[model samples]
Target: MPGGDISDLDKNRVLAQWLEWQLRQVRNRIRELEVQELKDKRRAEQARAGQRWKIQPQRSNVAALLHRGDCSLYSSEMGFLDREEAIIALAEPDIEACQICKPETGLVQT
Candidate 1:
C-alpha cells in the first residue's frame, strides 16, 4: 500500500470518528433544546398559576369619584397600567396627584 493512500482500516477509523462527533453534536443540540423547552414550559405554568385578581375598589367611593370627575377610571382597553398597579397607585398617597384641581388632596374629591 502507498504511504499517501489511506488504507481501508484507516478510512474506517476516520469515518467512525466523524460519525461519533456528529452524533455527539446532535445529542448536545437536542439536550439544549429540551432544556430550553422545559424552562419555557415552567415559565408559562408559573404565569398561569400566579393569576392576579382585577382591581375592584369599594363601590360607593369609586362611584362617587367617577360621578364627580375628581378621579378618572382607566378603561380596561387602555394599555398604560395594570389594574393592580393602578389600584396601588390610588391607595398610595404619594402616587395619587390631582391633575386638574388641588394637588394637596391626593384623593379625588366627590
Candidate 2:
C-alpha cells in the first residue's frame, strides 16, 4: 500500500483495458460513418435514377406535341415535365413516351 512497485501482470492488464476501450471507440465511429455514407449513397442513386425517366416535352416548330424524351438530351424547343407529373404529361396530346426508355410503361396500371 505504500510504495513504488506495480506488478508486470497489473501493468499488462491496465494496458489491455485501455487498448480495448480505444478499439471500441474507433469501431463505433467507423460504424456510424459507414451508415451515414450508405444513406448518402442511396440518396444519390435515387436522384440519378429519377433523372433517367424525367420526361421532356417534344414539340414541333409549330408548337404541336411530337413525343417526350429524357432530360439528358433535350431540344431547346421542348419543355421539361416534372417527375411527379410525368404520367399526366405523357397523356397530353401527341406526347408519346420515348421509343427507347418507355417512361409510360412504368406508370401505374390504373
Candidate 3:
C-alpha cells in the first residue's frame, strides 16, 4: 500500500517468493544430509555383516570354534559369548578383550 499499487488483494507476493526459495534450499540440504545418513547406515550394516564372533585362525575346515563353555576366546568374537565368557575370553593368552566392553576388569580370574 505504501510502496505502490496493491500487487494483489493484499498478499505479499515478493515475501512469499523469497520464503519459497529459502524453503527449497532447506529441503535440498535436508535431502543431501539424508543421503549421507543412509550411506553411513549402509556402511555400518556392511561392516557388521563382516564382523565375526570368532576370529581364531582355523587350522583346518573342521577346526572347532571356541565353545560357549570355554571362557577364553578372541576379542573380535563376542556376539555369542555372555558377560562371564567375555571376561574369560580376555584372560586367555591369545584372545584380546574389547577395550570398550572391558571384559577383564570386573571378571574373577580362576
Q: Estimate each model's TM-score.
A: 0.45, 0.48, 0.40
Give the per-residue lDDT of model 2 (tens digit) for 1-110: 23978888889999999999999999999999999999999788656554544444445643223233333444433344555577676667756555555566656375
The collision pairs in model 2 are none
Q: What is the C-alpha RMSD of each candidate to the true structure, in Å?
A: 12.3, 7.1, 8.5
- In candidate 3, stretches whose alpha carbon ends up further than 4 angstroms from where it belongs are 1-11, 53-110
| Steric collisions counted per model | 0, 0, 1
Write one digit per residue (lDDT tens) for candidate 3, span 12-55.
Answer: 78778889999999999999999999999978864553322333
Model 3 residue 50 lDDT score = 33
Top candidate when judged by TM-score against the true structure: 2
Better of 1 and 3 by TM-score: 1
Rank order (by TM-score, best first): 2, 1, 3
Instruction: Determine which window of 10 residues in candidate 3 has minimal summed lDDT.
Output: 62-71
**Each model's lDDT:** 0.48, 0.60, 0.54
Error of 2 at 83 (Å): 11
Identify the runs in model 2 with alpha carbons over 4 angstroms from their true place.
54-110
- On TM-score, the stronger of 2 and 3 is 2
Compose the digit string of candidate 1's lDDT tens values, residues 51-91: 32122234544321111122233222222333344445566
Instruction: Return the top candidate by lDDT.
Output: 2
